[model samples]
Target chain A: MRSTLLIAWTVLIEAIRRREVYAIVVISTLLIGAVATTRFFELQGLGKFYREIALQIMTIATNLTVIIIASRQLPREFESRTIYPLLAKPVSRLSFMLGKLIGVMAAGTFCFLLFMLVFLAGCQYLKIFVSPPLFAQFLFLQILGLLVVATLSFMLSLMTNLDAAITLGSLFYLLSSIFLSALSYLYQFSDTAVKFILRVMVFSVPQMSLFDLSEKVVHQEVWPPVPAFVIGQLTAYSLAFSSLFFLVAFLLFRRRPL
Target chain B: MNNSSAPLIEVRNLVVEYASRGGAMRAVNDVSFTVLPGECIGFIGPNGAGKSTTMKVLLGFMFPKSGSVKLFNREPGATEARRRLGYLPEVTLYYPFMKAKELLFLYGGLQGMTRTQLKVRIPKLLEEVGLAGRGDTLLKNFSKGMQQRVGIAQAIIADPELLILDELSSGLDPVGRHDLRDVMLELKKAGRTIFFSSHELSEVETLCDRVIMINKGRVVLESPVAELMKPLNLFEIDFEQDGQPQTRSVSGAEKFNATLAEIISSGGRVIGTRTATRSLEDYFIEIIRGHEGSGR
Candidate 1:
């Protein structure tokens, strides 16, 4: 575990220095900045518009960057053969994969935090009324979603090359985000076999949309009657799936030809 | 602390295979060898000779299809074993966006070397590798030789007991190759066990005490370099004349007699007819040619 932490810390720091984190920051800033600057005339409340745009930007930035960054993370190492030196050390395959997951997640969290700050500053300058805790929950969800995405990306990288991993990871990300929604609709039908298959698929995917309470907050709906339970579910979901993915990734990497 | 100091690495019939489009292709076939501490062993082979595959399996990057590999008598993949092992892959691929310091720090941290240790050791290593002032430069901007130096530094950062270096001089110029050779000699003198893999026979010839030559996934020969280089049965008769020494085709024992008769006839004397002593390059070529006909 000490070794794992050390490895994770190294990976995290390198991720920062490698400008992968900065790339996320610059792109997120641009996204939020553009959205915040957009003029919405009929919406009456300027603060509301800024807050809404900020939330949207934060969500999109975290989701897209996490997928793009994390998907290429391990595949790049494998392709470049940099993983050889690290794996040649006294690190377990599990530790290596987990370190990468943590590193990518840390990058996501840092990027989202930066996005959140920019949004807050924009809101303050615009005198917009924004829900800090609600926004915090949204950021938390984005982090969880990113963690799930990172795990899936790690798995895909182990199974395929960079381009194929990216394509498959993006598909998985899209599916997980809307998986439950698709299942909810499928559940509406009375057909048993179709509903069963949809349920199985939902359970198999990361159930990413479960963390999405931002839409509720945006629509002025009752902001999640069960915040703690939802957080717990997302936490357990991320940990379990991430562990499973790491196991699969490790097996794949162990068997892979160097 | 001689031969009885315990083997740094041990392998018993190790096998490694890959899942190919057609079927499972065995990359390393029932190969086995051992390296004792302080022994500088050369892993020489032709291309696709399973040298890298064996190294990868020993490093736990790839598991064997069969047989057991042990590092310091522990399971090869065990963390304890890994902690003591150092590896420089044939490809000196670093995170291109990372500065030399960041890359070394990452590698040091992975090896569980503390920050304090890194502070003291990194500069020393950089200086040793002659990259003292370039720590701030990103690896991507560095030349291939520079990257190779950093790669060497990364391998030795942890002060591992077992060093596994693959093609350490593959891309280096002659001077760079000499520099790498000097580093390997220094490591060996410091009581570290080193397993170096390369197709360049000269590099291995100068550095290794024992050479294990592999061709096409199997060990073609394994012996002390001195013993392997001992005079072979085939003789090279310089003939005291040039112009492609005349040859007559004959079979088996007749070939030897014909050569001796030619030498005796052409010789105002036998004029130093001696058994062949091949250079490392000649031996390498012979092994490669042997590969063309034999699957192994």
Candidate 2:
């Protein structure tokens, strides 16, 4: 565990030096500024409009940053031959994978929190009111969603090249967010064989939309009447799927001829 | 276990293959060797001769398709086995953003060293490798030779029992190579088991107790350096009057002595007489040429 954390810390330090993180931050700030100056803000319910836009930007920034970082972590190491020295140590392949996962999570969480601070500052400038509990729950769920995406990206990276991993990771995120719920409706009307395939596909991909509480937070819904229970379930779901992806990645990585 | 009694490294019939467009390509074929404690073995081979591939298997960076490899009587990837081993790769690629001290600390931490240990050891190692005050500089700014120095430092920071260095003298200037030779000699005195691969046969001849030569993914020769350096059935005798040097191809020591006496008695004034011995480079080339001729 200590070795894993040491690798994670090293990776986190390396990630912070990457220009991509700064680029994302700058783009998020610019987008927030553009949205604040929009003529739509002059209309009524300005707070909801601003919150919705700000949350969307945060979601996109966090998810994109996670996918890019997680997807390229292992591939870059292998391309540069840095993995040789690291794996040549006393660290196990499983620990190496876990350390990478933790590093991606840490970096993604930091970026999300930074973007959230920017969004909150933008809200303050626009005189938008955000309930603390709703904002906290939304932040928690956003991080959970990012974890799922990062884990999927890591797994894809181990199985394929960088471009393919990132492409498949983005596709997975988009499909899970937009069409995962619609799978239930499609399944009800489908034939038996098609239904089985649909069920398998749905089960294989994570239901990322479940962790997207942006709509609820924008409208201040805080679903299920018990935010703590929802948080627990989301945590469990993320851990379960992340573990599966990490296991598969470990198996592939151990067999890889570095 | 008694460290002196046990072989530090043992490889048995190791076979490693890779997939090619045509078919499976064997990188290492049925190679076996052992290194006892306090012994320095030099692994020499031409390009693509599986020297690096075999080192990778021992370092656990790659798995063998068949056969067994053990370090310190444990599996290669076992934590206990690796803890006692240190490796310097052929190309040491470190993260460019990290400073030399940070890189050493990272590797040291992975080896389970504490903060205090690293604080004392990092500077000492950097100094030992001739990079004393450059620890705060980022690796990207360092030259290739400087980076190689850092690679050596990191490899020895933990004072491992077994040091596996690939192409140890690569990218070093003449002075740097001389310093590395001194360091290696010091390590050998400290009872460290050193198994290094190199194209510098002179350095190997100077430092190693045994030489293992590989060609086309197979071990063509393995012998003690003394035995390989033994004189063959040829002699060269030079006279004091600067006459033409005479060369003799004799079958036995008695014939060589008789020829020497005959030349001296004839008032030839024998200045110097020596038997012809083959250097490691010549032997290596001859073995490789034979393998190529056999088309194996």
Candidate 3:
């Protein structure tokens, strides 16, 4: 566990010192700032629109940052030959990889925290009524979803090159909701074998849409916070898929000759 | 620490392969050797002769197709085995964002050293490696030679009982190489077992108690460095040519005598004569060429 933390600390240090996350936060703040300051032609649902746009921007910026950083971690280590001296020590490969996963998550959390601060500042300027419960759920679920994306990115990085891994991870996040919705609709009309395949696909990949609560946060006045049972199921769903992806990555990496 | 008198490293029938368009290409073919405890063994081989591949398998970074490799008679990369080991890779780049001290701390921490231990050792280790008072400098600003010094520092930070160094003098300037030699000699006196490969045969000759030379993924020669250096000798004739000094070297007394007589007869004043010995470099080139010639 200590080895894992040390390795994770290195990754976090790289993210912090590189100053790339700060750039993401700055860009997000600008987008949120522009939207917050706009008149929107004196629309009636201006608060909801602002909330919707700000949360979406934060989600996109944070998730993409997580995916990109996670995808590059292993490939960069191998390419730069940095893994040589690192693996030469008394550390195990499993610990090294776990450290990387946790580090990437830590970086994502740091990025998310910055985005959250900017987002809240935007809301404050607009005097919007934000429900604490729904906002908390939204934040927690988004991090859980980032873990899923991070693990998938790690697996893809091991199986393929860096760019392809990043592109695939981001594209999957963008299209997973549509893919799941389409699978559900197509299962009703498909033949037996196709339906079985669709069912397998449904369970094979994470249902990212299940982790999103942004819409609830945006319309908090219309609905109460999610119950504990749903949160439990979502947590289990994230852990299951993340484990699958992380297991594949570890298997590929354990015996690879660097 | 594997302190018993057993071999520090043992390998037998080790075969490693890589997948290519030409089917499975073998990089190491039935190579075998053993390194005894407290012995400084030099693993010398031509490029692509499987030195790094063998080291990777010992570190468990690579899996063998068929063979047994053991450090301390345990499975390679067992935690107990690794804890007693320190390795310097043939080529590596430290994290550019990390300072020298920070990098050492990370490596030392992985070796189970606490912060207090690192704090006491890092400054002195840096000075020993010739990088005094530069611990806080980021690695990005360091030259390749300076980075190699940092590599040396990190490798010895934990003071392991066994050290595996690949390309021991790579990327180092003359001063860096000298400092490393001094450090390695100290480790040798301290009874640390070392297995390392280097293209610099002179460094091997100076530091290695025994040497295992390989070519084309096969062991060509394995012997004590003393045994090899004993029979190999060279003689030199120092003379003046055009009011300037010159030296001519030859392998045998017959050739040395002839050259000396010729210089004197041609009105070149002979200043002195001395006997020297053949170097590990000469022996390495000769063996490799002979091996290739036999193959042809």
lDDT of 1 by residue, A174-222 (tens): 6655666767876898488887887787778777667676665554434
Q: What is the interface RMSD of candidate 3, in Å?
A: 1.1
How many pairs of residues collide in each model?
Answer: 1, 0, 0
Candidate 2 on A1-258: residue-level lDDT in tens? 988998888778877887888889889899888887786656446777777877888898789889998999999998877887788789988898889889999999889878888888887887777778777878888888888888889889988999999999988877665677788889989999999999998888788877877787677744433358768988999889988888788888876788
Clashing pairs in 2: none
Task: Write the number of the candidate with greater DockQ, choosing between 1 and 2.
Answer: 2
TM-score of predicted chain B, candidate 3 = 0.86
The C-alpha interface RMSD of every prediction is 2.3, 1.1, 1.1
lDDT by residue for model 1 (B146-175), tens: 888999999999998889899878777788
Whose lDDT is higher: candidate 1's or candidate 2's? 2
Residue B135 shift from truth in candidate 1, angstroms:
1.7
TM-score of 2: 0.91
Global Cα lDDT for candidate 3 = 0.89
TM values, all candidates? 0.84, 0.91, 0.92
Alpha-carbon lDDT, every model? 0.76, 0.86, 0.89
Best by TM-score, which number?
3
Which regions of candidate 2 fall more than 4 Å away from where they truly are? A181-196, A221-226, B1-4, B230-276
lDDT of each residue in B173-221, candidate 2, tens digit only: 9988998999999999898989999999999999998999988888889
